[model samples]
Target: MNNEVNLETYEEKKLRLIAILQQHSAPEIRLAKNTSNLFRDRKNISGPGLNVKSFNRVIRIVPEEGFAEVEGMTPYVDLVEECLKYNVMPPVVPQLKSITIGGAVTGIGIESSSFKYGLVHETLQEMDILLADGSSLTCSPHNEHKRLFFGFPNSYGTLGYALKLKIRVVPVKPFVHLTHIRHRDAISYFADLDNHCKQHIDFIDGTIFGPGEYYLTVGKFTESAPYTSDYTYKNIYYRSIRERESDYLHVGDYIWRWDTDWFWCSEYFLGQNPIVRRLLGPKRLNSVTYTKLMHLNRKYNLTHYFNTLLGYHSEAVIQDVEIPLKHCPEYLDFYFNTIKFTPVWVCPIRPLNKNARFPLYPLDPETLYVNFGFWNVIKSRKQTEPGYYNRMVEKKVRDLDGMKSLYSDAYYSAEQFWEIYNQEEYFKLKNRYDPRGRFKDLYAKCVQHG
Candidate 1:
């Protein structure tokens, strides 16, 4: 509904998926333009490479009003640029610009600004979905398709495939104020977030940079000020090309700052092939060899530090488990002591009020969700290897009755997956809304498998 029907496949899998959908469903399905480009064959990389390639596409449908109806497949990077051209932006935007809107809605999505605006799904006005019967329906809070709208976020693809979405957008300035502050521990991070949320700051999040080095980055928009041609570089000390003469820059734009350059960088990152990196730049190589051995494609790079760090040796198996805000500390201890992996990325997400009504995880009223981005470094050794650390990591997660995130194929088994989210009520809703079971896909198979 946004502008085009965007869908695509990586390598033969994409074709396989498309074939599967065409075979299982009606042929009248329209393949919208602007499909995903990330579906390159996983096993066909020319040289040492990342193992996975993922993609999100944008399908658009112009409404009677000026608003654009978007598909879940819509990529976040493009959406920000498209919306900004019209002076509007989604309330919640992911830090990794390449994340798909659909990916965020179906999975437990988060971003730096979540403290104020919540996840991307919270900003939706309506969703155009393809039901199991191959029919299309628009779902929203005010309409009859309300049940689908409510359950669709964490349901993965079991409920339905999003055709288009009628979403709310907000106006944004052209610049950003990105300030990096050093913190001692998690205590300072939370306190700073609390203080920043009360102000006009647009976004905030921090990284636990090793033992004592913590970087808390915050962003906000301000009025245009006078420019200083000869600038002394301070916080952003990493890398940059020599500045050209007469170029004015906005602090707020950051990555969304340039669409084409961002896309090229994203494409290179996701390519994951060492040869590609060699072709692009040797600087892309990680100093850590194990991380270099990961063969992880660019899409997974968008994941948090904890997941990527361990993913070097182990395929990441994350479970977006929730504990009430009060219990977050307890859960953190349970998680940290239980796993051997160093540097776990814990995202403390604040879910919408309605999501709280379900009480899926053992949530408290002040329930701030602590998302477990559990990392498992893939090892070349067999499963029987005694020293293998991945097994230990998996065992710890299994011990905790955490809700497994239903995003990538690397997640747990179907039984294990559902046990995390308890899809029985969702099944009942499925029966009520789509008795024919037309929405069946790998996601449906996993969620509903006996």
Candidate 2:
């Protein structure tokens, strides 16, 4: 490790970054980072990526203040490990380890803690955003850039990049006690899901194996557990939901329970195989390794080729959609009926601050919403048009007054996308912060994957 580089102050790093940005003469700006948790692919850009890799650092953790100052490209893994040193953790730590604090805010991030703290963005107290013009400014709920603060949540980096963020952190217990509440019916299951969110708890989320099998797993922080469970290696967390009714984990293990298997999506890369897992070991069992392998598979078109050879048409339905709690059961019914993909994730969340509304990703402040996260390919023996299933998901979400996270493939046209994502508010911020069009528009970046 370079102690000198690590000791460089935030101001020193900022100046160096500005110099690098000035030297790079590109028509467009994009982050040059080491990791990504995004599921979407982008069109090649004819410009050098802005090297913000060194911006990865934790400025400070003020336990008394209940916040941690983290750099833009700092991954949650790094941030969480540091926060834990102070016996504190981010209020809403996204499941994936590689997910950056900046990316999550600009894109959208949520977790099991969302029922109490809301989305990762909601845990934000303030941030200093580095704009396309190589300028930076602090934005908060009641600052001159208040609009930018509220509008930044779902911008997808179209507006600017969060260079530094002050995010809410809460003290953590040494262990977490988990209880899996099983529900055979969607109506009763979803009803109880909403009911549980009203109760005081540390973390809560749900999972579905198939029709008539739903597990609402709840966790409460504890000083100690009877015996801690380990999902980081051989034993899978998602599968454990069905095997055990109650469980316990160390605080760190509980916070990162999903990342070990990428919420069961690791099966795509055979990371679950006993032989493969043993050979790979715990180090390679994470989402980072699987994500890299997935990218490689996409680059080689191996899956498509095999599917064609096997006479199967597949559509990747990797998405997280938020539906009003009352209509979640309906969405579940439609999902099970149409998609039929088992082991979909279910997390309930509502606006942490009812008075604040993020226009770019609007949600009814008064209503609780259930986030359905399903990442798998839907295969058919027959051929279908591109985005056939994804289009269906978009339409159904719209019909039910739901909002979909834009981290993966989307089929929404420009007009329809704008209507849902608050085009007026987005453009206003774009005009104010990036009037020269130095960055790609949200529609082009997300929908077109430019």
Candidate 3:
């Protein structure tokens, strides 16, 4: 047996594996690090068009000058820890605690403050890739190899493997001030968001539990207090205690920021008694369901953790679509009418930075993002039957022309993915970097057969 072990990096491994497949007869092979499980269980309810069957095997990160050179497999939770030592933080982060950087990049990311910061791809400065030809290149807008920059944002792995990414980071802050304001409806909540935009909140995200009720949550650095609250703020007085908590759980990595961040939900629900908490789990609940049951009660924590490693397992057929700023009303009507069989939770987030290098959903400078996620016990519903939800979403997104959140392995056609980015340039770049069709399987279903 020839024994020349391949010492290629994780990003290069895909190309190496592809080459091996072309030459060898083996049908099953193992990878170094695998995260396909995260996607395997998730059913695509709508947009970001994905129905992933597997993920890359390994995720690695190499620290570089002013940035961390991350492999496509690095998990976000791990990357946050690595960046903490440098007092820097990734700009755009997904809401989940375990998502990978590659997943976020491919799916495109939006979080609490995407309105101000933009998506994860917005923070990317440069990327090193292994193309179909097994050649490596570093790409950036300012560099000679610029095509990769255009393709990296939403291409998933269709263009090439992102071997080394130099993403921008900001100084770590001690705390964030979270403001929660309840609204009676989408009209009232969105109006409030526009009114509050002048304060320049660090991040803005909120949810509507029912048709007439909403909650607007905003985040900002501690020092930049935009408003005063009546609640007693702890940790600020005890520096040592705060420091200890920081070491154990980095606040930046957690979506709520700090332990106190739990106050908004907990205070609203009254407390985390086991009985109430159990009710918080999967149910025949919709966004409106939460509101109708808890009407203006924002005091309970939605601590969705299964007691064991699986955490509190919950299921929701989420639907997300990007609409032009002026079309929010039209989109909302379409979304509301389609979900007769399930409950729906609506989330409207602002796109990362309004000003970005690439094409994200174009929003009216004043438009807020609108996301609708549902929750239910999958084992209890008939709609959960295979291919039903997928077919429904495919039809809705295509007819509505709204952008989908590409996080879950939701089914989406390659045509939808291409349409999201508006095609031509993406394919041109693909032809330039991977003319051999080595990354053919990575194409959106539409692109694959077209």
lDDT of 1 at 195: 64
Q: Write the per-residue lDDT of candidate 1 for residues 71-105, one digit (tens) a residue.
A: 45667767776776666677777544545676567
Please count the clashing residue pairs in each candidate, in the order shown: 31, 0, 42
lDDT of 2 by residue, 136-237 (tens): 899999999999999999998899888889899999999999999999898999889988998999888999999899999999999977899999998999
Cα-based lDDT at residue 362, candidate 2: 95
Ranking by lDDT: 2, 3, 1
Give lDDT per model, in order: 0.48, 0.89, 0.50
Write down the lDDT that model 3 would get.
Answer: 0.50
lDDT tens digits, residues 265-365, model 3? 33334324445545554231112233333322212323323212344333335345554434555555555665543334344455544544454333444
Off by over 4 Å in 2: 1-8
Which candidate comes out best when scored by lDDT?
Answer: 2
Lowest-lDDT window of 10 residues in candidate 3?
236-245
TM-score ranking of the models: 2, 1, 3
